[model samples]
Target chain A: MLLASLQDVTFGYGDVPCLEKANIEVHSGELIAVTGPNGASKSTLLKLAMQLLHPWEGKVTLSPTNTAGNKLVVAYVPQQIAAFNSGFPSQVTEFVRSGLHTQSSNWLRRLTPQAKQAADEAMQSMGVWELRNRRIGELSGGQKQRICIARALAMSPDLFILDEPTTGMDKESRKSFYTLMREQIDRHGKTVLIVTHNLSEMNDMLDRMITLERREEGGWKCCTTTLCSGHFAPAESLH
Target chain B: MLHYDFMQRAFCAGGIIALIASALGVYLLLRRQALMADMLSHVSLAGVAAGAYLRINPSITGFIVAIIGAIAVEYVRKAYKTYSELSVAIIMVGGLSVSIILMTMNKTINKSFSSYLFGSVVAVNQLELTMMLAAALIGALFFFLLRKPLYIISFDEESARTSGIPVQWISVGFSIITGMIVAAAMPIVGVLLVSSLIILPAALSVRIAPSFTSAILVSMGIGLTGTFTGLTASYELSTPPGGTIAFILLLFLVSGLCVRKIILLASKSTSKKMRPEIAVKESRISKNGLSSNLQKIRQR
Candidate 1:
């Protein structure tokens, strides 16, 4: 099923168009990479897909049937991992447990056993379980990013969207992250969409690539691998 | 200590303020809008001054006017969404200007207004205590009911919207809660010191707790501790409780930082011992000529 679709979408910030005439479709268990230069509306497109921004033209729809009435379960990892001032006291486990916000109803009480187990599993999957009790401010950038991903995973969303998930990481860390993402896509059958500037670096892991570019005649052009390169291949054409 | 009726009222007021401030503080710290609380508190001062000029109960007038100010701030923020900070600055200036104008217009200066500006523990009466408890209970209930949506909004707004959480309403709800705390805290800590009662404990709490629950608990502990210590110290030294509470809160912030530093140092020392294993692994790879072999394969 087409999990999400953006047809002839145009988005703007108060009459200043950031994206124009863009179209895309994302299906289940696919790793789609959105790549473009700065100000090509990469982030804006992701926001539109996530329903954060309403498009000025065209329709962006999430199939409710695919979501199965679990609208609150869509996980997201933002580009910048938020920084708290020194002496921020939140533990890694606590941070991860926040992902379960959609699963339970009580706000004032503690997490349930199932919620606790999910949080633990998420931390373990992200390889940050050992640091669960440690303070978030004490973590390195890569470690913090992993914890953020773990937080998203704890939601157990069928669809996951990440904005620059591997930014500011070493090459080894990036490789490990892609491996984890691949495992989630393959093993868990989770649909993934990521917005990244470093397309050349991520080419090997992407199942398909979509580029948003400005046309000479006014308006934006969205070119996908199948339509632009005339290559209707799947993961094989990624490299 | 509890024999005096006034003291009992003061303690009750302080307890209510502690819980409300702690609850609001968690989000304020999370959103990094601690300064907004300060701005709102200062703005509410003008309302108190106006109440004093009219010879009306300042707490009631102050709360009504403060909610209006909070709504004004929200409207300004919505109007100039991109330049939200400018709205906060404008409100700060407008609030200060109003206070000065009201004070200058009234020839007979009210001592109560001055005491409120600096804060006075002796001013908390049973009526004020009852109001504080009611406000605290309502605030607690609202947060408890909307905790999930609030968490999502606090962490990331865009995702929360897509997840079906009403982002706009949540923002409004948060502002209302802020207004309530500002209102309830005024009678206990006074206008100028109210923001401190909300922010300091929450900031310190976030440093030690890993989860939101733990963070809230830590904030409550800090709030209660600060209030009790400040009250006792003020009574013993014949000093103002507001200043004492601020001083104690600052001390806790510094101590929390020191503890974090020590932990970091200890971790660094432990990681140093693990470095040799990494070095040994590298040496083994080099000895096996696997690195060069990979390089040769890549070159082809």
Candidate 2:
């Protein structure tokens, strides 16, 4: 089923057009990688899919099959965790536990038992349960990334979007990240859209790869490895 | 210090302002908008002057003006989007300009400010005390209800919005309440020193606190303690209460930084001590195993 779709989408900041007439589709339980050169609007497309931005001229739809009543739960991690730095002053557990506020209806927010359990379980899954009380600023790059991923897992999201999550991680950390990605897909059945420059290292956990190309005049062109075999010989070489 | 009713009222007013400033200050400091209090307080100065000129209660006028300034800040911030501090700077400049004009128009406004200007704890009358009490109670309620949202926003705005938290409304609400609290605190800490009350305690808290909740609690304690200590010290030394409070708060911040540095150094020393001990223990164990292997070879 279609998890999200964007049709004839064109968007820009004032006069500089970034995306034009872009059509994209995401299916349930699929891990899709979005790759592009700088200014190719890969992040822009994900934002539009997440409804963080509206296309200047087209329609964006999410959870088209499952929108009977409840809004789909989405967990979106931006490229940079700007507030996170050494001496930022917060514990890993508190930061992870904040994800449970999404399920809260009360103005006075507290984590319910189930939400707490979910957060703990997520932390355990990410192998950061032992570091729960540690300050976020003291964590390593890989550990911090897991903490953020654990935060998303605690949300029990139907759709997950991450932008350049592997930018600072090493080879071992990237491998562990892929393992976590497989778990998210095979176990939890989430539809994921990842913006990455590490596509060459993204060995086979992906369901699809979408490439965005910046055009000569303005806007961008969207292409998939499968549909345009000529552009990428053997399709796998696109990675 | 406790011999007079005015001293008692000063303590009470000081305690309230300390608590309110501690709570609001932590969030502002975390957001890197500590200047919000400073800017709003400056804007409130014009109101204070206008009130004296017109023979109205200055704190009341201050409250109204600061609230308006906060709203203006929110609007200007939204319009600028990229440079939010620019909005605050503009408002601050405009406020000081208004203050200069008001002061020039009515020289008696300086006398009006004397009661709260240098924080004349001796001058806190029944009306000002009641006003401070009411503002403290209301600010407490607002903080309690908005605590989670505020935490979420401060931690990360993008994640907060994605989580369906009303970041915009919570931010605006928080800013307004902060302005109100600064105005209410004027009589205790004075207009010039209000930002110190808001930022100093929180700075001290974050330096040593292990967690977010503890940071807030520690800040409140530091604030109240610093304020009361300064009040008592002022009475004893015949000094200006506001300047004394500010100096005490500075002392607290300095001590906090020193403590954190000492702890860090101490931990590093202990870990250095443990590393060589671990290495020796491992070497001894390996030597024992080697001797056992040699004994086995001899038996063979």
Candidate 3:
């Protein structure tokens, strides 16, 4: 089943268009990697899919079952880890537990043994279990990224959207992250849509690649390539 | 001493302000916008000065004008998201400028500026206490009802929006609550130090607590303790109560830092001792495994 669909979407800030006429479809249990240059609106596409930004032109729809009839159950890991001030002094466990913000009226009252177990499972999956008691400010870049991913996973979301997940990681850490993602997708069948500018690093792990190109005619063209083809041709070229 | 009505009123007013400030402080610290509270406090000074000039009730006028200033800050922030610090700087300057203008106007009108600047705890009547209590309760209710969305948005706005949390409303609601708390705290802590009552305790708590709930609890304890100490010290020393409270809060913050450092040092030494033991155990396990393998080979 199609988990998310963006039909002829146009998005921008004020008058300047960041993305135009872009369309994409995501299926369950699929791993789609969105890659483009820095200003190519790859992140914008993920934001649109996550419903963080409204499409200026077309409709972006999610399957009702996943959204629980309200919106998609999306778990997003943002690109800029620095967006959070490190000096804020939140514990890793507390930060990860914020994933359950929607599960109860008061977050303090709803932290039962079951919820803790789920958080522990998420931390264990991300290899950050030992760091749960540590402050978030004390963590290294790779560790912080993993903790964020664990936080997103603790939501038990139907779709995980990550923007530049491997931006600041070392080679080994990036490989380990891809291994973890593979385990999540293959064993647990969680759908994922990741936006990254580093195409070469994620080439092997991606099930499909989607590219957003700014056209001379004042819009964006989205082209998708299956893993078997090993190349992303232009949508117009394919037509 | 127990028969003194003013003392009872002072305690009541101080308690209410402490509650509101500490609760609001939690969100301010979490959102990393603690400085905004300070700016709001300064802005409320102008409100108090305006009230004095007009011979009106300073608390009511302070509350109204502070809310308007807070909303203005939010609008400016929204308009300049790319340069958020610029928005804050503008608000700070605007608030300071208005305060100076109002204070000058009050001087021309022969109104005393010291009462608004330093506050008069002896002047906190029954009506003012009632107002403070009402504001505190309302602020508490607003926080409790919107805690979930507030938490999500505080941690990560993009993630919160994607998860279907109303990021915009949460941000606006938090700003409004901050304004209300600033207004409520002004009469007790005064415009100069009111924001400290709404920021320092929470910051100190965040440094040590494991969770947001614990942080808030710790903040409330610190706030109440500081408020009582500050009031008593001010009464004894014949100084401004707000300055005393700010000083006490600063001392608590310093102690928190020292305690945190000591804990870090202790944990580092303990980990150092355990590291060699872990390495030795791993080597011994490897040696035993090799010997057992050799014995099995001989038996085969």
Model 3 agreement with the true structure over B1-300: per-residue lDDT tens digits? 325787677777887788778878988877767778878877777777788778887778778777777878888987897777677788878877987887776676435556556666656877677778887888888888777677677777778877767677667777777777887777676777777898989879888877666778889999999888888887789778778888998899999889899999999999999999999999899989998999999999
> Taking the candidates one at a time, how many backbone clashes does each contain?
10, 0, 0
Better of 1 and 2 by lDDT: 2
Off by over 4 Å in 1: A67-72, A82-88, A103-115, A169-189, A197-207, A218-239, B52-56, B78-83, B255-300
Given candidate 3, what's the lDDT at residue A2? 88
What TM-score does chain A of each model score against the native chain A? 0.84, 0.85, 0.84
Where in model 2 is the C-alpha error above 4 Å?
Answer: A1-3, A54-56, A61-68, A82-85, A104-110, A217-239, B114-116, B274-300
A95-197: candidate 2 lDDT, tens digit per residue: 8887777644744656678889999998998788999999887888777877888888888887889988766677877777777877788887777789987
Candidate 3 clashing pairs, residues 3+ apart or interchain: none
Residue A9 of model 3, lDDT score: 85
Candidate 1 structure quality by residue, lDDT tens digits, B112-212: 57676777666776666766777788888878788767766766676666655677777877787787778778766677788888888987777667767
C-alpha RMSD of candidate 2? 4.8
TM-score, prediction 2: 0.88
Count: clashes, candidate 3: 0
For model 1 the TM-score comes to: 0.83
Worst 10 residues of 2 chain B by lDDT: B109-118
DockQ of 1: 0.38
